[model samples]
Target chain A: MIQLTDIQRDFQVGDQQVHALRDINLQVAAGEYISIMGPSGSGKSTLLNMIGLLDQPTAGHYQLDGQDVTTLSDEQQARTRREKIGFVFQFFHLVPRLTAAQNIALPLVLAGMSEKERNKKVTQALTQMGIADRAEHRPDQLSGGQRQRVAIARATVIGPAVLLADEPTGNLDSASGIEVVKILEQLNTNGLTLLVVTHDEALGKRARRRIHMKDGLIEHDTLQNHPSLANP
Target chain B: MKTRDATRFAFDALRGYRTRTLLMLLAMSIGVASVLVLTSLGEAARRYVTGEFASLGTNLIIVLPGKSETTGGGSPNLLGGTTRDLTLNDALAVSRSSLINHMAPLIIGSAPVSVRNLQRDVMVVGTTSSLLDVRQWHLGKGQFLPETDIDRASFVTVLGSTLKQELFGAKNALGEWVRIGDRRFRVVGIMAAQGRSFDIDVENVAFVPVASAQMLFNTQSLFRILLDTRSRESIPRAIEHIRRTLRERHQGEEDVTIITQDAVLATFDKILRALTLTVAGIAAISLAVAGILIMNVMLVAVSQRTTEIGLLKALGAPRRQIIRLIMTEAALLSSMGAGLGLLVGQIGSNLIGYFYPALPLGAPWWAFVAAIGVALGTGLLFSLLPARRAAQLDPVQALARR
Candidate 1:
């Protein structure tokens, strides 16, 4: 489970303080599928960044899977991010210099796994994402849908419990976007806690729980179909 | 991250900027190679001078006519203007010391030599027959100067190979009569061609008796006294004894300077080593320039790769890992440059050795170690600023930095 209590984030733009997030309180159960919908400047990205440990909240307590992680050291937070949370982006964020397979193997490499084990896991991830045939291709050589598939493979290769995606299909055509959404949903069905921050109403409604944000505050929180929360 | 994976990632970055990588490597290698080559030349010069000194015979000491160290200094002593002249007796007296090995009193001048109307001006060295033993110079034909009393004025002479060739070409030089200056002398011996020494052509001079040379030059003063000590360890004692003996002979005045071959050689060794290091330092300045180039290029690279660094952060790489990544790239470039520089340096040394086999032109081991160490050190040290900036970038700002 992920919990945020009274989270506040401020940015100093020029001489005045700008609130990027304010009094945000939320809970995400394990294996839950949630979407955050808001217009530009709604602080949805900042919230996702905070949950992924990419940014720090100005004030608040954050607990991921029941452990307060708000005050973790940088290295400790990096380790927590590596082991428990993964991120996907609208750009796919593939390293252009690496092949599709090497991209997926990066997290395993960071974790210092044995070559034999990393190779096995990377191969499995490639096959699972249906990009086995494209494993040796660099990102520029792949289509938008294929690139996102590679990114998905890379994000989940370490088997993180929670996956946070921001504008995951913002750059893709509708046809490719649908394929990416289906892949993300399948991973959620397999018991990964999935959080999607987006502007698409159709994709937002597909999530079991949805939160609406405006001007750095949450406007609504509703559950369409609650997810199973008791998987070991 | 595994060190191997980090290294591979750094190499990929380097490969991405192929032109910049090549330029840095070129600059670094040139710096290292210049240091190696210049130091090798300096070392070889020192060695060559040392070898020449060794060839002058072992444990040798030279006695010159003037005191080189002028205590009550007026104007500097004019070259060749001595307060007093060393005589033949002074050399003979110095020879009497049991610690003295051998003595050869020398008188040197140049005059014309003629045989059957063939004439050329040739340098003449006046010394006793002990000169052959003192100098360890071999006779090519016939016996050397006859052993006679120091004042006996023997009219016989020995011809060097070049003088013999000039004055008695295709004739039996040992039996020929040559007119030196206004005197007629019989050539009793001819010397082998020994190379030049102390700027004088050893094979282009005639050898004659000391008294005869005094008669020929109209001077009773000996030019210089050359002698050896009984053993290497007895050199200092020999010099002290000779100095005391000479001071007494000159009426309590130290009118001459004694030069030990070892001391002169050591001084030259020190001077040459200092020169080598100075030039090596100048070459090291080029390494500093290359290091600055690395810093400039890397700073630019950090901003250009902001997104990638942000991605690395998102993928759970710590700040230390990011620093390591940049440093590894710098290290790889420097180490490679050092390697290539050494190869070029060794090749340069080999080329010098090939063209001048007697030069002894090979870089010392310290040159190798120091060059590599400084290049790598400069590379890593200069990369710190860029590495810090890369590590300190905010992940969100970096990701959004297009």
Candidate 2:
């Protein structure tokens, strides 16, 4: 579950103040699949970063799983992020020097997981992402879709409750984009909470719950039954 | 994060960027190696000088004519005009002191000694038979000059091993009459090869009676009076006695300079030790330059890896973990460089010792410890700015960067 009330984010470019997010309020239940769509600079990404605990709100209240996370210390926030949230960036952000398997094992390593258990989980994630044969490949050595899959595996390998994907398929080709979306959908179907921020209308519409933003404010929030989810 | 994982992560990062790592290693290794090699060279010079002084006999003192003038004064009295000459009588008077053990009045000059068709220009040392005991020299053939009265000009000479070989060939040099500076003197002894004493080649000199040398050199003053004390502890008392005796014999004037053997050694030791530290300090500057290089390189690396740092932070690495990773990388590189420099320095010193066996060049244990400690310290210290920059980086901006 996630909650945000009167969340305001401001940026100072030079002399003038820029409002990136203004008076935003939202709430979502566990295991919900949601998409946040907007034009550039519409505060969609800023909202996702706030929810991911990567940025502090200029003025707001944020609660995650009944804890007021806005009041948490930096260390406690990091721990909460480690234990409860995962982020998949548009750039895939895979450490270029690490192999796909090592990339997926990073969160576990940060959590001080034993090598044996880390290797086991990494292998399972590599298999589940269907990048098992490409486990030894570096990010630069993989195709756009495979790299995104590795990034996704890295995000979800720690089995976090919420997954935040900011344009996960933004850099991929049409087929690869569809495949990544399907993998994300599969995870969501398995009861993982997924919040995707994207500019693609079709991808945004595929979510069960959708929110649209304009001028640093959410203009619409609605739930819809996607035909594919009904059939599967 | 686990230390093992942090270490491996740092190592892998360094390996991924080979040129940066190698450049840092090169700077650090050169710094450490130069410090070691330079200090060893200084150490060897000190050792060589100390060894030479040790060989020049202990508990000894020398009295020279003329006071050593340290200040610049054009006054005639301060010049050599009024300086009293150290003479045989002065040496005899000093010798009578109860604190004195043996005394040798020395007058040194260069003269050609001829034996039949063979002649070689040799340093002539003028002294009594006690010179042998005072210098701790051994006779390879017959006896040293016989001890006679201070006024007696005995026509006796001692041939150094080299001079005897050149003049007498394989024949017995003892009892041979050699012409030295237009005077024929019987050779009473052939000195054993004693290598070098101070700056003079001991094996190339010829020794004669003090009176005979005074006559040959046409001077009433002795060059120096060499004295041995009863024991090491008696040298101070003996020096005071000689000063009083010489002052009494020289119209109540203290014109002669009394130099205790330990004083000369101590002065040289202080000078050379300071010189060594100076050179070592100069070498240490190179280490500072190396540390600056590390700082510059690490600064560049943090910017280059901003995205990676952000990713690590996103994956829940704490600020300390990030610092640990960066610092560990720098620390590992410098320690490896230090290890390499130690090996190179040992090899370099050994090679120097092998070619020139006289200077036993070995870095003192403290040099090794200080070099390594300083290398690691500088490495960590200089990398701190970049590590802090990396740790404090905003994960959002960093991840947002390409």
Candidate 3:
């Protein structure tokens, strides 16, 4: 579970001030699937970065599992990010020199997991993501879909409670993107809170909760009432 | 990261840029080679000069005349002045002291000597029987002139080893008649060869009685007075006594200059040491240039690998680890250069010795250590700017780079 209240972010560009986010308030319970849809420059990525603890808001109160994460130092923020949040980037930012298994092992390694434990978790994650055979391939050697699957495996290898995907399918084709979206939906079904930031309407409709943004403000927040997927 | 991991990372980076690493290594190799070869030349020259001076015989003193005023008030050449007329009486006065072991009043000139049809220029030295002891000369074939020969103004002459070789070829030179400046003199002995000194070979000279030389050269003035002390420890005191006695003999003029073998050797050492240091100093400039080259290469590498640095940082590598990675790359380049330089310098030293046997070409073990230290220090010093730049880069900005 996570909560953000009265979050504000500002940037100084030469002599002018730019407001990136203003009076943002949001909350998400555990195991929810949410989609944030916005046009370019609508502050969706910035808000996602704040939620992922990758950037700090100028003024805000952030509660993660009832602890004030806003006042934590940079190192402590990184520790919390490593322990509770997994990030999936649109470009599949896997280290070029490392194989898929090594990339998947990174988050666990950062969490100070022993080598044997890291290897075991990486194997399970690779198998779960259906990329076990591609584990020995580097990012450059894999297809776009396979690379994104590896990145997702790397993100969730440490078993974080929340997955924040920023346009995870933006670089993939329709078929590969559909496969990635299905994988993310399956993880959400397995009790991981999933928040995806994207501009695609079709992808936005797939989430249980959808939020649309315009001009740095949330335009709508909608929850689908269909029970067929809930039982499926 | 641990030290082992950092070292492994550095080695991998170096392997990735093998050509650039080799270029930097070549630069440092040239720097070290210049230092080794130039300093070795200076060492050889010093040794050669010292050996030549020592060959002049130890504990000996030579007194030369002081400068005089020329017609236009310019200073006269001290050595070119007329002989100071030191006599056998002065020589006897110095010899009477317990410190004096042997003494000789020398008169020297050059003439052409001939035997049969062979003729060559030869130096003629005139002195008492004590000249043999003072000059450390020994007879190789016949007897030296006796004390009785000096009083008799003996026409008997001693041929130098080279002089005999020149005048008689392989024939026996003893008891043979040689024509010295139109006067026939019988060679009574042949002195053993004493190699070259001050460009003149002592083995190419002939020795005769001082009274006979006075009659032959038509001069009563002595060229110099040579003396040997009874013991090396007593030579300094004996020199002072001789200086005092000579000043009195010369009417308190103090016009004579006394030079000892030790003083000459000391001056030679000082000059050589300065030359060696000067050469080594000049070579250090090349080393500095090599350091600059290393810095330039490291900066280029940092720029080229910005994304790599960003990736490492994102992977939880600390700032210090990044710095160690870059610095280790630099050290690896320079140390390889130093190793190659040592090999090149050793081969060069031996090549030079093959051409000149008198010159010993060698590098002490400390030279190798110092060269390696200089290389490593240069690498660390030059790597600072680039390593710091790499460490301070923002991960977002770096990752955004292509």
> Which 10-residue window of candidate 3 chain B scores lowest in summed lDDT?
B67-76
Point out the higher-scoring one by DockQ: 2 or 3.
Answer: 2
lDDT of 1 at B382: 92
Question: Candidate 2, overall lDDT?
Answer: 0.89
Q: How high is the lDDT of residue B271 in model 2?
A: 93
- When summed lDDT is taken over every stretch of 10 residues in candidate 2 chain A, the lowest stretch is A223-232
lDDT-based ranking: 2, 1, 3
Highest TM-score, which number? 1
lDDT of 1 by residue, B1-402 (tens): 899988998998898889988988898898888889988988898888888878788788999998888775563454334578899889888989999888999999998888878898988888998887777788899999887788889889998888788777777887778899999999999988887765457778888899999999999998899999879999989999999999898888788989988988899889989988988889888878888888888888898889999988898988888899999989898888888889888898899899999898988888888889989999999999999999999999877654
State the TM-score for model 3. Answer: 0.76
Task: Evaluate all candidate structures by whole-model CA lDDT and list the values in order.
Answer: 0.88, 0.89, 0.79
lDDT of 3 by residue, A31-129 (tens): 999999989878888888788776678998999999999998656766787778888888777767678998788666555567787789999999999
Query: Largest lDDT belongs to which candidate?
Result: 2
The best-first sequence of candidates by TM-score reads 1, 2, 3
For model 2, how does the per-residue alpha-carbon lDDT over B1-402 read when each residue is reduced to its tens digit? 888998898899999999989988888999999999999999899989988887778988988987785445676484555977787888888899779999999899999999887889989988898987887878888888997887799899988899888888898888889999989999988888888888568789988888898889998888888899989999988988988888888887677888988999999999988888887888788887888888898889999999999998888877887888889888888898899888888888888999999896888787898789888998899999999999999999999987
For each candidate, give its TM-score against the true structure: 0.92, 0.90, 0.76
Please give the TM-score that candidate 2 achieves against the real structure: 0.90
